[model samples]
Target: MKAKWRIVFLKEFRETMRDKRSLGLLLLFTLMYPVMLGVILNQQIKRATKPEREGIELAVIGAAQAPNLMVQLKQKNISVEQKGPMDEDAITQLLRSRKVVAVLRISDKFAENYQAMRPARVELWFDSAADNGARQRDIEEVLHAYNSSIASARLLAHGVSPATVAPLQLQRYDTGTTAARSAGLIGSILGFLFFPAFICGLSAAVDSTAGERERRSLEVLMSQPARTWELVTGKWLAAGALAVIGITLELFLAHAILSWLPLEEIGMSWRVTTFDLVMVCLASVPLSLFASAVQIAVAMNAKSFKEAQSMLSFVVMLPMIPGIAVSMLELKTALWMYAVPMLSNQTLLREIAKGEAIGALPFVLTFFSAMLPALAAVAFATWRMKSERYVLAV
Candidate 1:
């Protein structure tokens, strides 16, 4: 003989499985995040592996005035296009169009200014909001080098050492490793991978509770011999089971995509091994349960499916707030982070991705953080269902 909750679990699970629309939503959420992550990372890898200055195009308003500058730009593999003198408005439109990395406008007085040993006025125009900072910096470096060379020549001709005007020579050495630099980027991605847990279970959770109520079937179920806790537990488990499957598949797919990509080229890595991933999946199980439990508790209060969905839409996004806040503030990883459900899973995965051998405390904290909340939600839902007002309203 099966327990009442087990019977209810099987029944709700089968009904949820039978809804093609529910299954379709589950599949979509499960695949969408991993695919998005893969595509984004792939683009980064492509950009990183591309040759520097391979296809930089620069527009010069007066190319004839600075033949030496043009030669230097060409030598650096930058293709320079000559254009007639343009006003600031024209240059701004050109930059907005993004046809060139930047525009170098040489003043008509450049030749006279150079001959008279006055500072030449050259303007570098670009869209600061555009993603061409690196290319713009390259062009600026060439201009700086040309200026230095001419300065050195003038000093030599005047019987003065070029070093006389210089007091310090500076060089930079970066101590941060590739993995360290890429951690924030990878962490942001990992944070969203857990999003499917909330989405995949949402329809099923809402349908099994609020949908049933809207159809007036919930009253009949409530009147059954089964206790309120049993019914709530069964529904919670069914929704949670779907969430678990969705998140697990998403994580594995993400792992496959990240592992196959040449992340090393971009100073990023997915250092989680098979064993580490298995542990991560295990620790994340409670997060899915927590999502389902919270959804069930919240959805049961709504008078109809539409209302429940509108409310849970906001609820689903609530978990991401903490993670985003932490990222925005650039907070350091600490043990307390693992005590916050969604953030815990994100931090744990980030640590593992950085090849850290974190001990069992994070896993324990992650598990219990969500697990306890889940149990409390289930309890609250059961108590809510058993209330006189709830029964009368139904």
Candidate 2:
């Protein structure tokens, strides 16, 4: 004897496949989502790898008065555009136009002050609101180093050690690894990859539950010998199967794109191997199932196709909240993160990307966290279907 759920499952699955709109959406997301991710990351890589010394221009109001400063700026790859003496308004307008990063003004008393061994004032004019903070800092660093070099020379000429004036020395050591640097960026990207699981099966779930009821066909299907649980499980499985296939393909395509791109240039990498990828896909199966189960449970309550679609749209967005919260708070990966469905998948992928030895615990937690909720939703949907009010409405 055949299982009644299998009969319904096969029927719904075939119908979903025959639905051009559903299939089209499935195909579109499977191809486009990953390609979009690849394009975004590729742009980041290009930006990161671009030469920093290019495109930095500085305008000097009194260039001839500071020949030594010009040489220093030139050595730091800063192009000096010599300008005649300009008043404050002219310098402010030049900065507002953004043709140069900053304007360097040497006071007329600079040479006299230096000759008398007094303070020589040089002014740096910049627009703080501009997106040139890094460039501005680089220029300021060059000026600071130039000042130190001159101070050291003057002390040496006076038979005094340059170190005599310097009581303490400070140095910076960066202990951050490439993976550490990339964690936030790659983690954010991974969060979005699992969203297709919610989207791919939306049409099928809505159609089988709310769409069927609106067409008056669900009443006939319910009259069959199969129990409510069987019917609900069948529709749930059908929707889940589509989601599974879509998310799995999307992940594989994304993996290929990530592997092909030189993410190392941006200090990021998709370090997951084919074996690791297969494992991740396997673990993610329950996430698709959970999404489909929730869709089926909620969409089944709606009175019409449009109602279900609108309601399910909100349900789809629910999964994104956890992932977005983790990102906004910049939370570190913890075992508890594996208890959340969409967030679990995201955390799992990020851990895999780190190329670290994460044992089976995460995968197990990720799988069951989604699986348990899926089964519960299916149960609730079955209970709802069995209610007298539901049958009366149908």
Candidate 3:
């Protein structure tokens, strides 16, 4: 029986490899994912490392009214362009031009109000629609520092301690590390990394089952002496093997790209080592098998290649629902997450990227989560194929 299945497996595997379209798809997904990921991450790193003041161009009107404020702004590395007094319309045009981050207008009564110990009016004009949030925040910080200095000086002049206004001095300390903060973003990225396992063998699975039936060869194969389980197992392994190869190569290439790039620049880290990646690939092997088994079981029921492809396409996306729902809910990881197939694999990789030392249980759960279902799918397909109805249809 084992020999019969092995012969069937080899035959199907050889036939799948002979199909250029299937092989081309396998290669495309294997290379496309890592290249795209690297490009996106490289762009992010470049953007994050750019100089903070590179775009902080501020236009200040009524510079004479607050000469000291102008000096303070310049000291904070802000590039201030002095402008003559203008109306709100003119200021709006200047901001709309996008040449400057923001405009600062000092009222004409500013100097008089300051000398009289009254609150001076300073209007900050900004385009809220513009992508100058960082620059605008920097300008606001400088203005805040200038105002606080003036208030402290006024309090001292009145012979009162400035500290009297601040009974509570609270200092903020952020305990979140860069890696910890980036875990969520990286988790989303890694969630799609395993998707190729389903995609890589989709064409092969559809063609082997529905395509053969459409071509009238499935009846011939069924007439052979091999039992239903042997034929079904052979086809399942053939498609699953393609998925395995595609996913393994993809993981290795992605690991190389991630390890070479400086993810730390964007407050992210790919802390997975070579050994860890190999172990991950090993654990993920059953995912490919599960995907292929499910595809074969569904596609075998279709009357034509197009119908099978359409049906399995929807089935392919079902695994991603759990991952998406988990992300949307912002749920913390629990032991049960390890039993949820695709979600478990995603969670495992995410925890590994965060440099966590998750022990052997996740690996065990991840393996069996897919393996058991895969065996069940193959069994069902075998039984379905043996049915009198299926025999008559073929």
Candidate 4:
């Protein structure tokens, strides 16, 4: 019986390989997905490491009123562009152009107020719509420092202590690292990597089942000495074998790309070594089998190639739902997540990428989650194929 199934398996596999279109699709996805992911990640790293601002450009109106302040701004690496006094409309236009981070307008009574030892005013003009918050904050810091210096000098000249103005001192500490910040993004990226299992062998699965039936050859094949289970198992393995090859190659290519790139530039890390990746690929083998089993079971029920293709399109999207829902809910990982097939694989890979020492339970659960359902699907397909309705239709 094993020999019979092996013969059937080899026969189906040979026929699938003979179809150049199916071979091309399998090869394309195996290469395309990893390359595309690598390109996207590279772009993200570049953007994250790029400098926020080369220099904070500030527009100063009535610059002569506060030459000392202008000198202080320049000392802080702020570039100042002098302009005559302008109305609100002109200031708005200047900010919209993004040529300056902000406008510093010295009040007309600035010099008088300074000499009189009275309060002075300055209007800070900026466009809230622009992405200049960091540059604007830098400008504000320089202005505050200048004001504090002036206040201290004036207080000392008046025989008063400048320390009385500030009763409290505060310091800020940030505990978040780039790796921590990048974990969520990296998790999302890894979630999509396993999706090829559902796509790579779709054409082969549909063609072997519905295409065979539509071509009126299924009835003749069923008349052979092999039992229904043997025939179903052989076809299932053939399709699953293609999915396995495609997914395995894809994972290896993605591993190479990730390891070669400097993911640290964006606070992300790919700590998976070659041996770890090999283990992941081994654990993921059942996912392709499960995907193919489900596809063969569903597609065999369709009457034609186009019909099978259409129905399986919706079926292919089913695996992605769990991953998307988990992301939307922002749920933390738990033991139960490892029992959910596609989600389990995604979570396992994500945790592994984080360099966590998750013990063997996740690997066991991930393997069986797909394996159990795959066996059930193949059994169901075999039972369905033995029915009088399917036989009559064939």
TM agreement with the true structure for every prediction:
0.81, 0.87, 0.91, 0.82
Residue range 39-146, candidate 1, lDDT tens digits: 988887776654373578899988888788899999999999999979889999999998988999999999999989899999989899987767788888999999
Question: What TM-score would you give candidate 3 relative to the actual structure?
Answer: 0.91
Off by over 4 Å in 3: 51-55, 392-394
Candidate 4, superposed: residue stretches over 4 Å from native: 22-36, 52-58, 64-77, 84-105, 111-177
**Which of the two candidates, 1 or 2, achieves a greater TM-score against the reference?**
2
How many residue pairs clash (N, CA or C atoms closer than 3 angstroms) in each of the candidate models, in the order given? 0, 0, 0, 0
Each prediction's whole-model lDDT (CA) = 0.88, 0.88, 0.87, 0.86
Compared with the true structure, what per-residue lDDT tens digits does model 3 show for residues 252-352?
89889988999887777776889988888999999999999999999878767898899998999999999999999999999898898899889988887
How many residue pairs in model 2 have overlapping backbones?
0
What's the ranking of the predictions by TM-score, best on top? 3, 2, 4, 1
Candidate 4 residue lDDT tens string, 1-394: 4588888899889998898876887798779978998999987766554324367789999899999999999988888999997999999999999888899999999999999999889989998888676667778898899989999999899998888887788899977554445556778877778888998878878877888887878888898998999989999999999889988899899999988989887666777889888888889999999999999999878767898899999999999999999999999999999999899999988878766789999999999999999999999999988986775654
**Reference-based TM-score, model 4:** 0.82
Tell me the deviation in Å of residue 48 in model 3: 3.5
